[model samples]
Target: MKIKNSLVILLVMAFGVFLFQVYKQHQTQGSLNKTAAYYNTNTPDEVGASNVVTAIVVTYRGLDTLGEVTVLFLTAMIVGYILRHGGKEKPMKNNTSEILITAANVLIPGSIILGVYVFINGHLTPGGGFQGGAIIGTAITLMILADPLGSVKKAVLHITESLSGFTYILIGLAGLLFAGGFLDNRILPLGNLGNLLSAGAIPLIYSLIGLKVGTELSSIIASINETGNKTA
Candidate 1:
């Protein structure tokens, strides 16, 4: 088995080296294609985003992003399945210090606010829905730790996740019907370039994504915590 593993690693390394050499050979002869130039130069005007990265991700490649979000949702479903068997466990008595609980209560609101800010400005700033969602998930973790007996509502999370996903799909369809193409940012009127309302549909889509992700992750965390209590 060790010999087989070594041979497999060697084969993979050699294949990677061969691919790298081929890429290097082509790199010298290749220049920026028309598509690349167009994406680089015209993305801002076309997508109405000061953040080129956001434009490419949520506008030019929106379908791929949606697919990725779907995969995450599937993962959440799997986690829910695993946690189902342990859901009968009663919540453990809270042992967290009062100070810790109070501090968490104070900070959770701020974390949620920060998460919203990140997703809302995704088209104009560095952060986006994914990052923002993770932040909100962290806040959920704090909430669980602060009061273990105060269970997070799985039903609420489910509703939030479903609504956000449905909204995202509706927005994509709207773009197809009303704009230049599917996931086009021009469906709604584009406001000022750097303003909060400038990037049509992108911000709304990202906000939905953030909410979906945050709720899914929170549900997963709740499930895991419940499972842990059963084992404990």
Candidate 2:
């Protein structure tokens, strides 16, 4: 009875905290802080990206983005290593529904194409590398769900992930060397705004990010699926 009362009190306190946070956010709504105001005022002239959020993420705070990707890579590596050595392989049961299989076949290609389009035009649109890469990863996940025993080419994923990460770093280094600072998009011509080729190196940088994120996510999903198969 004492433990139950304590639990109830804890829950009420947590709920009170949540309400306080919500009220605080409401109090501060619709206000652009100094950082936001600065980004909004100067991002167009400086970064040339129509998507202000992407400009901030991929350029102004690019080192943070690099660290995020690095963390994701390490997570994938750890998950793969642990799962790969967890147990011996066993044949996966083929219990997937035909509807799911058919849907995966039909949607995977379109999904991949959309992912590519999203990352390539990230500077001009609302979507960016992370969103696009997640879409690609979802498609691969769907494929895995459809066929439990299907083989994913880990070698290709590894290669693509490595190359993209390497190229991403090189692009950042190029910006540091030739332009304003690290990951500065001004290394290449900014070109005409709103055009496909505009935004200098942002599109290229986002493309590399998309590829790296996609491959890393796919590799992680494949590892999980393989381990599930072995355990099943």
Candidate 3:
């Protein structure tokens, strides 16, 4: 019986490896289509948001962005729950000086602006919603690390994250219900590509993603630091 079980496990593992190989091949095939001229670059105007990738994320393949945000949210929730459960966090060191905090305060908004720029230009250039959102998340982490005492409110963070998630899904559903596909650009006016308002719902979705990433990352950082000072 034991040998039979071992053999079954080996077969399962081999099958899993085979599936992984197939997945890799499919991914390569998909990449080959990226440079194709039919790859949605025929926008009416230039993508308005700074990032070209953002356009691709929210406009062309928005479903993937939705899934990515869901993953981030689930990760944050799981990490917070795990860390909160008898898992004491070590107190964060107060190594950041006042000068550094002040500089962070000045730069946080700037970083956010730059992230928005990336999302806006996603179609015309390179960056997009996912990249810009990640940038914003990193910036928010810097703020939290620099000013642990002056952290953002948890209630606000929850609301921000929830709203962003809701807005993104609702927009997608609207497209599915009325428009063509899952992320069809119906509600948002598809302005000329390369222009500021181009790509319709793409900017809205990317901004939501950015907001959620920023708040979610900040919350994760706070979670670690929140209970670390427990009388140790």
Candidate with maximal TM-score: 2
By lDDT rank, best first, the candidates go: 2, 1, 3
TM-score, ranked from best to worst: 2, 1, 3
RMSD of each: 3.2, 2.1, 5.9
Query: How far in Å is the alpha carbon of 122 misplaced in model 2?
Result: 0.9
In candidate 3 the C-alpha lDDT for residue 40 amounts to 42
Please give the lDDT score for candidate 1: 0.88
Show where candidate 3 strays beyond 4 Å: 1-37, 40-55, 86-95
lDDT, residue 189, model 2: 93
Q: Alpha-carbon error at 3 in model 3, in Å?
A: 24
As a whole number from 0 to 100, the lDDT of residue 127 in candidate 3 is 66
User: What 10-residue stretch in candidate 2 is worst by lDDT?
Assistant: 84-93
- TM-score each candidate: 0.84, 0.92, 0.71
Residue range 155-207, candidate 1, lDDT tens digits: 99999999999989988889889988877878887787899998888899889
Candidate 2 matches the true fold with a TM-score of 0.92
Write candidate 3's Cα lDDT for 1-232 as tens digits.
9999999999999999999998888743434365544444553443344444455567677777788888989988987897776444555567778897898889899998998887656555776666777778778777877877556678888898899889878888998888777877656666665666666777677667777887788688777766554433
List runs of model 2 lying over 4 Å from the truth: 1-5, 11-15, 18-26, 29-31
User: What C-alpha lDDT do the candidate models reach, one value each?
Assistant: 0.88, 0.91, 0.72
